[model samples]
Target chain A: MFQWSKDHLLLLWLRLAASVCAAILLLVAGFVLLEAFEALRDIGPVRFAADASWHPASEADQGLYNLVPMLSATLFATLGAVLLAGPLGIASALFCQFYAPAWVAQLQRRIIGLLSGIPSVVYGFWGLVVLVPLIRLQAPPGPSLLAGILILAIMIVPTVALIAESSLAAVPEAYLLGANALGISRVGIIFRVAIPAARSGLLTAVILGAGRAIGETMAILMVCGNVVAVPESVFAPVRTLTANIALEMAYAMGDHRSALFVTGVVLLVMVVGLVAVTASFATETTHAESTHG
Target chain B: MARGMVQTSGVSPMTRQPRQRHARWLDGTVRAVVGLCVAAVVGVFCWIVGDLLLVGVPELSWGFLVEAPIDSGRSGGIAPILVSTLAILAVCLGVSLPLGTSAALLLSELAATDVRLVRVVRRSLDVLAGVPSIVFGLFGNAFFCVALGLGFSILSGGLTLACMVLPILIRATEEGLRSVPSDYRHAAAALGITRTRTIWKVLLPAALPGLVVGLVLGIGRAVAETAALIFTSGYVARIPTSLLDSGRSLSLHIYDLSMNVAGGEPKAYASALVLLMLLLGLISMALSISDRWLSRRMVHT
Candidate 1:
């Protein structure tokens, strides 16, 4: 009887602790949403989403919130990163999965592990010192959309490659054996069989990579020229929704502060949406695997 | 036209010979492309690490590691930043580990019987893990700094980072707990030991390795974090005396020195080099430790 009560008490404590963690996440989402509603109350959702200019300082009194230009910059960087990282990441996964020697594969894993562990600030410092100057020699402004895109691409490649490699590795050995029995070449097996088998998982990897790239702030803040206008070219400097919040949050007050929270809400929505998509893809892949087995 | 007429005249294996040759060439091209992509991945890693060491090694001196900022982070060392970074790391790990471990225990032991509860907990963790660090910063500012009235101090930063690392902890620790064999539980039950005692004595020791891995991973995230700490932990360059005192982290030090202060670029590089090495050490340790633990478990089983 004593043992039973002690066990119940311990279980209760554990459950309570776990509930706190869940509650914190809920509170964060709710708190940000509440602040977002405050901003929306003043400016409404339509103008906040569709306005082209982001002149928060000039219209601070009236709260003119324009997120189009910043959202475009964010989209351009995310898309650019996906375009650059997707092929390299998938191909490297192929190398790791099918071609590399065991030691080489292990070494590749270690390198990517270290690369992914590297902090965004360190990447930003490297970008500020190396890529920014390299760009400045050719272009007038050192920090531009191209710099942000390049840095984010490099930063997210390891994530994409790691996930892609794992998914590729998970492809059944029987599939490879069957392909080999059919007299398919090594390259043919990888491209025609292994890749197709891991397609959904690979898509998840790319989506998660995009999510990482878009949520990135300090690195982009360092390389992306914090201009408020619509970026005209890849060389044109721009701000992302994240950079906008980081830059303005320190000094913002009242409705302006709420506006920054609104940007956070937008970022939150996009990331949650990406997470949901990736989760669905992951579930689908698992379901397929279970059914096959 | 002549070639087409010839293929039509002999359309069996004669035409197939050229097609096979073309396919071989295409296969070779694809192989080359894959190899090149692999090289690019390795090359980029080398480039970043090589560049940092090449540029930053000259500036790294014993004096640089031990001294405080002399001229707005231009001429001084990173003593204060190191101390505060370690402080925040300790505070965050200390707070998150118990909460996360208990949470993992709950999920793996108690809630394992409840399918809906497990799904909800897992989905929540996924969403939390995917949330942006900057948003964590915002939430930290509003919740910890303002609402809780902890202000912009290490306490707020640690609390925010605790939130950030909780999902990592729960996921890793839950995997650890689940990996423990049920035979141990059965043996304990056969001995007439209470369930609580069995869990405490049998399950936790078995899951220690996985819990260590999770701990290391959480430490890595806490150490590398900058955005979440920026608002919650105000960037004071001096050594913090308490959890409520604002302090500078190595990550924030690198960010401020490089971006805000003119002539602080070299110091930024030096700090970044240190941060990179620290992160690399933690990650390598995490990998090797987990690998070793897994192998040892396999041997034991």
Candidate 2:
């Protein structure tokens, strides 16, 4: 197999390698699709989408998964994170891009990088120490919609700030200068001219941050206080579809286990939808800016 | 580089911004905000590493890593769990590296023609990348464990993890492959070299640093995974003598320990510190390797 001609050995090897790589992709696609389909099939095609009830020990446990509750939890946590990070993240972005000295800006960006690198589990650990203790004094314990929201919100800031900083970077110097030319106050211009221009991209950053939050698992599992009831209140401990699967999948046998797979299917569909939404906006914003720039 | 820089910096001379907005005070405001943002981020850092160090450091010892699971037979040292994590991590690399690199080569070389199969494969890779780890966990358990009768073992778990890492590797490889200059390809082609020869000698070597980056990211993910491993690896704490044995991981060890530790045991903190240290070592090593390789590559070329 070892040959003197770089052409012979390299060409032959690359060809062989590419085929294997293609095979890798095909194998993964085949396996996951098959597994997902199998899970879907067992859940029954007729009632799969409509099932709302998700009890493991009841007669109608096979009934609807009441997905609205879990969906609400996922959406609520994501939205709550955005709600917390939106104003704060944007202000931080603006501050770093236009206001800070070079050294300060670099330092800020480095901090964001370090924050993003820290594991989500650490966030959960911190939340368990500070937040769970705080929540325990007021409520019974475990897996609350509020707890998930608070933890997710805290975790989402670095993501939001990272993307938001980039969008702020993309704003042309001309807009700020042009607005200033028109006698707009610097604060007014930043609010009116720069932000409005960067609106689509900023929205992309928000959605991107939301994706990081919704996709997160470990911390949410730690603090979400995993009661499976529909979130009657934010403080009521409840399980998202993710927590439900994590809690029960290992021990459940047969149908009980299969139900856990169904929960995963739901989470997957939801995540893909979120990914698509964010991706589309991200491309659209980038495309828009490029053409105009 | 100078020309491109000048071109990007040049803008229409239409803007007469107010001197008021450009006052030195704006500089102060910007500096203050950046400082505050950096402070917030650092605050989060302090909270996590500080809390973990304070809470977890006191109980950490070699004994923690060597002990068996106890406390309702559910909590203990994570020797077996550590072994399982390494075994699965090793297995993922074994499966992913060759296949991922090969795919990267194909994408770089043959991708110019834009074949339908290539497009489909590319999209499939993207979908696979986004398919979520938990879904992979479910699939790995069902198809690998239940169907192949591998049960909950290191091999199947690693196989599933391989699938998880494949997309990341391929994507990284694509970036690496693309970063290779076309002039090198042209020179090799002009020299009557085969396409494959040029790719290996001229391209892959050039892309090695990026490949290393990709590998680091993939390894980070594989090591951190808990959900997928929970299903496919099975959470038994043991020093597995074979790949077929079900075992726990550092994260799973943490999970297993926390759930059953009766909430106040010093051992919980000890093992948590061990797991944290394990992660820190992986990250720091990956960072160092990438840095070293990047600097060497820059120097070599």
Candidate 3:
């Protein structure tokens, strides 16, 4: 009876299941690699990387698949959004975690929850009705990097703010008390002690915000006015890899479509690599904070 | 004599000077700046939601919600869109929960010594989690729809979403499982319970809250999904009788409506509103259940 048990049965199945799991992992990698090879074959590595123009449908377009402008545009938009939303998110998080009265903290938490809950489509709609015209009037062109950046930045704020707040809250109350006892001002304590103590978590929040910005499609598409050229200026319309994929996916045929999927694959690889790096940094920081500090 | 008496005496509370008016002004200014920063973040949320509700409500009518995509808004109901949404949700849950939980169980119970396998699984999940919805839509369309002959059905889209949400679910389940104290396992083992039985009976209940949270987040992601389903699930403006049928989700419906794809703006706005309501309802239930579970956990603990 003991030999006929659940643990024994599970052990019997584990080897089979583990191999299947490994195969499933290979499936995604295989899918991405096959598609990527097709893209390279069509465009070649040199032309694809060096050419800064991406005109899929233009009659007179040279075969330049220069993704530099689009790549920069994506990076700039993400960077711009972080610049706009990151500090403000951190400040609000500080206020929530430390300075705010209890009721205010609860209210702020609730507000952040609600804000994060709003769907991405709704964010795009809001950008469509409000930001699009606003950008057109203020900027040189209607849908430029600035417009996309601003909207994307807005989308990332709640993400950064909420995560930062939670991490800040996780900081041991003892550190703050010690800083206070040393006659450190409130602001100084926050800047010097609290923030540093929660550095790893805060970094994670920022990285997550960056991830959100890069992955975002609809809102950026609505406002970026994807022109598929290297962004000459901040106010110039340019295509992001994400927007490029979304715009072309529906109508693209044969190589045109497969090419778009390859674009997605590239974006995925880039994002995954970056996130891994960020996580490594965060891990080191957390270890340093816990074991060393 | 006067200096000694006055200086050595305890200082009067009243001797301290009031802050200069300039300092006061600076304090007020600094406070205002801080207040504005706080308001700036909060204000955006208010304005966006306010705009949505205001713009969407005027067109929010029984006709818009019930009616399907009509050329001149004469006919078409979101009933079909609603049905498709439910179908996708059901399939998403079914696919993701098992895959996520099984992987999590392995991480918790087995593979205890193999750091390489653990690292690989974690990275795979992380990569999967970070892939954008647009990318998911692309691969999902290719693998499931074209290659496998699932053919633009709810199953294809739902399966894609499952992949999308699997990482999140696994992370949540792992956190939940990690929270299960060693004492419980020891207690079970002391009674000579099988490891699998101990995990099934003791650990799962203990980690239910985190698991619930992960499930909630998964549902939220699945519900709001647009891009992946857009490619694989062809825009059929009908209620799906089964998961096998190609369908349109509420998110897709809203996108089509907003983009005036089928030239149904008002109806799209209504669908957006409906989508918001459904999502909010799911969120509240998830929260309450998690909350209740936590409370019960506290009592039992």
- Candidate number achieving the greatest TM-score relative to the actual structure: 1
lDDT tens digits, residue span B96-204, model 1 = 9999998898889876565676667778888999999999999999999999999989899988999999999888899899889888877888888887887788998
Per-prediction TM-score = 0.95, 0.82, 0.88
Residue A29, model 1, lDDT:
98
> Per-residue lDDT of B182-217 in model 3, one digit per residue for the tens?
888888888887777876789888888888888987
Ten consecutive residues with minimal summed lDDT in candidate 1 chain A? A52-61
Top-DockQ candidate index: 1
Worst 10 residues of 2 chain A by lDDT: A56-65
Model 2 over residues A201-228: C-alpha lDDT tens digits?
7887787677667667777887887765
Q: Which structure is stronger by TM-score: 1 or 3?
A: 1
| Chain B TM-score of predicted candidate 3 relative to the true chain B | 0.82
Q: In candidate 2, what are the lDDT values of residues B113-232, reduced to their tens digit?
A: 646646666766755666656677877887789889999999989988988888878887788778677888887778877666666678878887778878877887787777677789
Interface RMSD of each: 8.0, 5.5, 8.8
Extract clashing residue pairs from model 3: A51-A66, A52-A66, A69-A230, B66-B77, B67-B76, B67-B77, B68-B76, B68-B77, B137-B228
Estimate every model's Cα lDDT from 0 to 1: 0.87, 0.69, 0.74
